[model samples]
Target: MTAATQPLLPEGFRELEPYVVDWALPTRQERYDMRLSKDMTELGVFYDAIAPRAEAAIAHLDTLDLDALPEPELRLLRLLFSMILVSYAVNVFEQPSIPDAGAAFFDTLVEPAV
Candidate 1:
């Protein structure tokens, strides 16, 4: 099959495919930006969907070499990264942006190679 026709996520992760467009960001900044843009309800929906499958997803990713992940696996990794960001908002802050941290912006200058 052509790359264009390939699945967005690896097998067994098809359930998460629906979230790929919005949550599967490649960089920490992108995930952070997404977190900031969404509300608690939106973030909660994502959290609810992924949290249940996190252990299985991590196990699947662990079988692959991080530097050599194929397109679909890489996307799965990014989805996990996004879940991390959303978790903080859903569980801790209970809001999109940090509490009492108005107008203060923090940028993730560097992130580990995907």
Candidate 2:
């Protein structure tokens, strides 16, 4: 199966995956647009729904050596981390700027070779 179509983690992270039913990442413009609803209630609901999968992803991530993953898997891992950071910023910290939070989160990650 192609990387996008492949099951990265069976029975986990299905809801938060890109193109999934619950996937939502605000664009840089959206972050600055406070006129839009940045309600945590909806984000909380989605986070609660995906908590199990997020935990599972955390557990699975612990098992892998990041530097050893292939290019495609590394990209997938980045996606997972991006989702987690966005959720943390919006839900936990109630941060209004997704782009800033994303930049902060990724800034700390050690880049592995593609």
Candidate 3:
């Protein structure tokens, strides 16, 4: 595919996009389970597989000038950040009594003014 039609995320990372469909306005569980889910080994595999892709993707991202990225690429970057941030949250916060609190906080900060 030409660059215009190519997937915005770095190759393997594109598969992770669906989980972040509403990253801008995700429910608590959506945010909380962004990594592994105890009942879904497939998701667990996906979570496990993403680390290398994330490292490569972030390396690619660092090479770009954010202000100059095409709109689609920028949106893809936002999704990439969401994945990284959710992983970080789980590590730092563990399972919280309020699963969605972080999602709500992020929606306020990141969601467009629509």
TM-score of each: 0.93, 0.41, 0.47
Model 2: lDDT of residue 97: 50
Which tens-of-lDDT digit does each residue in 11-92 have in candidate 3?
5566755544444223334544544332234333434555557676667767778658754456556555555555553445
Quote the lDDT for 1 in model 1: 95
Candidate 1: list runs displaced more than 4 Å: 2-4
Mark the regions of model 3 whose C-alpha exceeds 4 Å error after superposition. Answer: 1-12, 24-49, 96-114
> Candidate 3, overall lDDT?
0.50
Evaluate all candidate structures by whole-model CA lDDT and list the values in order.
0.90, 0.48, 0.50
- The residue pairs that clash in candidate 1, if any, are none
Across 48-97, the per-residue lDDT of candidate 2 in tens digits comes to 55555656665776677866864434444554544564576565567535
Give the TM-score (vs. native) of candidate 3.
0.47
| Residue pairs in candidate 3 whose N, alpha carbon or C atoms collide under 3 angstroms | 28-100
Task: Give the 10-residue window scoring lowest on summed lDDT in candidate 1.
Answer: 105-114
Query: What is the Å distance of residue 44 in model 3 from its true position?
Result: 6.9
Candidate 1 residue 105 C-alpha distance from true site, Å: 2.2
**Model 2 worst lDDT run, 10 consecutive residues:** 27-36
